[model samples]
Target chain A: MSDALHDPGTGTPGPPATPVLSATGLTVRFGGRPALADVSLDFPRGRIVALIGPSGSGKTTLLRALCRMNELIPAAVTTGSVRFEGAELYAPEVDPAEVRRRIGVVLRESALFPGSIFHNVAFGPRASGFAGDLHALAEEVLAAVGLWAEVGGDLDLPASALSAGQRRRLCIARTLAVRPRVLLLDEPASALDPVAAARIESLIHSLAGDVAVVVATSDLRLAARVSDVTAHLDRGELVECGPTGTVFTNPRSKRTEAYLTGRIP
Target chain B: MTPLATRDLLGTACRLGAALTLTAAIALLGVLLVQALGVVDVGFLAGAPSRFASRAGVGPAIAGTLWLAVLTAALSFPVGIGAAVYFEEYAPRNRLAGLAGSALANMAGVPPVVFGVAGLALFVRGMGLGPTILAAGLTLAMLALPTVLVTSRTALREVPRGVRDAASALGATRWQVIRRQVLPAAGPGIVTGLTLALTRTVGAAAPLLVLGAPAFVTHAPRTPGDILTALPTQAFTWSTRTEADFAALAAGTAVTLLVLLLTVNLGALVLRRRLR
Candidate 1:
């Protein structure tokens, strides 16, 4: 089912082609109700792309579906193309475990294990048989997120002591430590104060030079600040896609304009 | 109404009621153990139970119960945890798996005596193994199966979904994720179930009787094929015997068994806290 649509979606015109991931006609239905219908977009390598939309506009659905997580939830069915590195992600017998490892996710809800913050960040690398010093890697990643300087001496402190914004960055550091080819973040900075939010935005910009980052958010202002290319989705369809500046400055669809003007959440 | 009076009404009543219930149950355990152990002799620890009512101890019986408890722990711990992992993390949430899961839990509630009969038919007689420690151990395993499984499953289920997700998200295979993340987080709970199951096996007599654990053995059975006597069966036998001395011997054995249970429960508790 996904094979036939890959050619057309993958070939869809985008500025200076060569996308790390090109999803096409990515349809997902939960008990015959389409949560995402024919949602196609491309994410170029080493670029920060944003998926912005209103509630129920298929932002998270598309993000999760791209990694083949629809199958994890009972009664969910995914069809069409979700290609990563030009490889069919939904191909039969392709291990979803492998797909997810290559495509790490920072969930909407922050979660840290019941252990020191060091264990939370080291969780990823340890799972992949990373025999290197986990504490060192944890320190490195935390330092990268500018957390080491603050919490460096207390590496053994419980994760429960961390503030909400710190937990968000720790989650990011955890994902980054795994060295995933693609990073999928769902509302990475939604709960943060302006200062923390700007730091996260800068982190996104810093991450763009190495990995393909796809940030799914309903916050148009955040999308404008973070992404190189922005795609606005409305009711499971890709309504508009362009450079972040062009799309927000002169949105083609009424839905995009409404979203930019705060008419839509 | 005064604020203090209002606060004291239902809340204090409910608190009193709950505390009384807990205290009553614990008191009941103490009374039963003390009564049952009264049959054991004072010198039983250093001596052995005998055919004559005048003789000293229930050493063989204590030994048999120890054997039974240890064997149950050894057999049920790994298998119960394996079953739990399969059901919680690996099994598809289909009708068949769900039914199997419920059936396993229901199996725990089966009568101990019935398990004894099955054990006799299958291991003691049908398998041609005759009365032996293996049959008795297998019988106890059947009886303890449900507690072990339910506890293990509950513990495994309590593990945060994010732990598994994070591991899989980081490219760990299902087995790897379970090994690295799920098992470590859930280990404390599994240990708890095992300790409870072990404690239960120490007191049960019906199934042990069916498996041919003798009422009394002057000498401890050396191997699985040898006939054995468990502490509970010996305590019951001694209490009914026409002798007052055997009663003291049974009391001592009862005390010893209670201590064993306490030790295990405390150890599991400590391990659980450490893990946490």
Candidate 2:
């Protein structure tokens, strides 16, 4: 157990690699009621972190805060610091748009634009002022998501024509087109069926090599299946954080144990 | 009566009421058409207004109305839609925003004649523009502005939040999200609103009258500053002359205005459908 803490499954480490994103004493209040309180965590590069909690446990708020999206809410007040690549995300000099560009957030509902599928995928690159070939970028991202074969020939079709699973992948492709370094997914599979959910889980696992992925989910089994690290949040507090296997089998906190065993209610 | 019989009775009453309303509308249009049919001709359409009612034509009035509609649309659409975008997308959700939104809603319901008086004060006397087509057009634009703003705000608000979030997630600036996603999604509604505003402006007689649009103009307006008479004003003038020929001419002018309005509305319908 002592050796397991040092061995993060990646063999070559004297110490853990510096996280791509880190939060220190992060607290968020919306109209003076706390949504998240004093959350401090690190998201390492090339890893999948699952944020599991019940509804209103601040899982989504924390994910949004990382990319400074919480600011979009009118009364959302955030204190403390979120650093992405060693720069404060909420710094006066930092642009939220730019931060979101580097750290893409994929919402549960497939939010495709009311345009052609090709345009939906190309939106990110075009908005980011990508000077490269837009068509090629769309093709590349679509292929990465394994959606090119189905949607490639019908690039002119409206995005609304896609099925649920296809729309979800198209959204992922949209995010990938911008070439983000960190990907935050809020319940990416909650709206999907089991087969589609499994596919999305595998997709998230596959994406770990390219970007640091944080998936906020209420599904504990999904967290156990896909995440390298699991963080349990309850009532706006981080109750436990550890390796996925250890946390599920041997939780440090009674709250986490009760939650896993269906005793929290 | 049994509950089932009561439901049937209510349904029958609703159907009868709808039928009556539709029939009344058709009957009124039929009367207007019968009155208008005799005076409408190529000669009446093409000839300029004259002292002789039989020789008078609606050509100048039609042209003036077209010019007013175009200028009013051009002036109002951009400004009104811009204001809507500001209120819906850019304005912070605060008391000031709430107050401004309420004020705009109230403006939409203000009497058209009040807008005419305002146009009279602001554009004619204040700007020294005289009672030219520009002043009339500006007055009609003011009348249309509130309708455009209110309806456009509704259109913009109809854009789904998820679509906006998707654009923002793609790193689009606030303006880019609105331009690329929100506006396009809201396009059909916006077009519908603009069509309604322009149609209302074209049918307006009071504001143009307040602006002192000429009852008779010799030539088609060549510029915004040219003196002009619109269709409603022309029809009103002809109706008041107490001559049977002039009354017939008024009905003809009304039919022409109706046709013009229908054409504009149909074009807008096609545009809105295409946007959808």
Candidate 3:
């Protein structure tokens, strides 16, 4: 357990030392119903922030808004501002594709393309017009996710043949192959077994120093175990946010405390 | 009866129904094969049509049909696939898009003769393409375009939304996602649809007839502009003739057309299986 990124004391999070991405009063509505309402947060570089909420807590919606993926839904309307590094994400001149490349997202379904495992990982780089050696890059990322030894020899095999956990790892590897600066994972391990989930948690922990990570999960124990910072959302609103230890042990909001203790309906 | 017995009885009934349909199709094919066996010789395929039925052949018609099939496929497949990609991926989810979708669906069910009439007015007279293979090819392409578009749209829709979102999240532009992910995922279905459209166009004579495809041509078409006669037209012409041998030649031409359709369909089947 590396405590290098975790703050020592339990307290509300002050202004981040180096904010990689920040949302100020971001609100999203679908068909006139709010999915995320007046939510504001900062994701600092080299840290993992866990978003914990029950279903329909706007966790997924916030992640999608960060990457501008919410635009894919025709009825989704987003307001307020999202800034990555220093630039407005929804600026007229900003390309959503470029934003996605910089801030990669791993969806809950772990959608792997219908091709070889190598091709699945290589697809991102190739689509972004990567000019360097593709094979070496793919190998490097696959190894990073600890999939090289098992799938290296048979990179040509269809990705659909892999088990659920392997497929999830492959999705992460594919995102990493593009060398994204920020990674947003929506329940990356919720569907996996305990062992696999732990492996994913550790992998995410190890990745914090190189890339900022925001993980949205329903599992509070997983959040408590892995996150340096935790933000609790309820009914499309931010309920409480602070250092993980403080938020878990002494949440200021009754809603957050009830939800954490399984009292909320 | 027990619930399990009732379930088994329903399943057996469905199986029997399917078997009966297959049996009927095989029986029809057998009859056609028997009728076509004796008259469909090398000369019947190689020689040109003549007043004397035994001397007549389908070489020119076969060449014309091939030209029409190739040209129509070259024109329709890409355009139809492009339209389908637009509708499935890029089109806005608005009332206009909805209206266009319904219009496209209705177009798929429009009579082939209606397309033929439109092609006659549009390409033959309006464009001044004249009654040449080019004109007929364009006409048949129009006839098959709706089916290609509709089937291609369905195929593109069949690609998982998750696969599309994954590609987009990896920074692929809309075109890149469609080209690299959606298109390849839907390849087998698109190929199957295109093959089926080509088969239908190849068998159809009404469109070409509307475009004034000649019933008899002695020489094979050497270029798109050359006047042409297709297999179905030749078969139709011969079947209407008074000579008994001409009727035999008609069956032979039908057999030749059937063989060409089967070869294409079988090739598509093999391709689809390989893709899967």
Which candidate number has the best lDDT?
3
Off by over 4 Å in 3: A1-16, B1-20, B273-276
Among all windows of 10 consecutive residues in model 2 chain A, the one with the lowest summed lDDT is A1-10
**What TM value does chain B of candidate 1 have?**
0.87
What lDDT score is found at residue B202 in candidate 1?
65
TM-score pick, better of 1 and 3: 3
Better of 1 and 2 by DockQ: 2
Docking class of 3: medium
Report the CA-based lDDT of candidate 1 relative to the real structure. Answer: 0.79
Interface RMSD of each: 2.0, 0.9, 0.6
Relative to the unseen true structure, what is the C-alpha lDDT of residue B70 in candidate 2, on a scale of 0 to 100? 93
RMSD of each: 4.3, 4.8, 5.1
User: What's candidate 2's DockQ score?
Assistant: 0.71
Q: What is candidate 3's lDDT per residue for B122-224, written digit by digit as tens?
A: 9889999888899888888888888999999999999998999999999999889988999989999999999989999889977878888777799999899
**Error at B37, model 1, angstroms:** 9.4
Question: Please, what is the TM-score per model?
Answer: 0.90, 0.95, 0.93
Q: If ranked by TM-score, best first, what sequence of candidates would result? A: 2, 3, 1
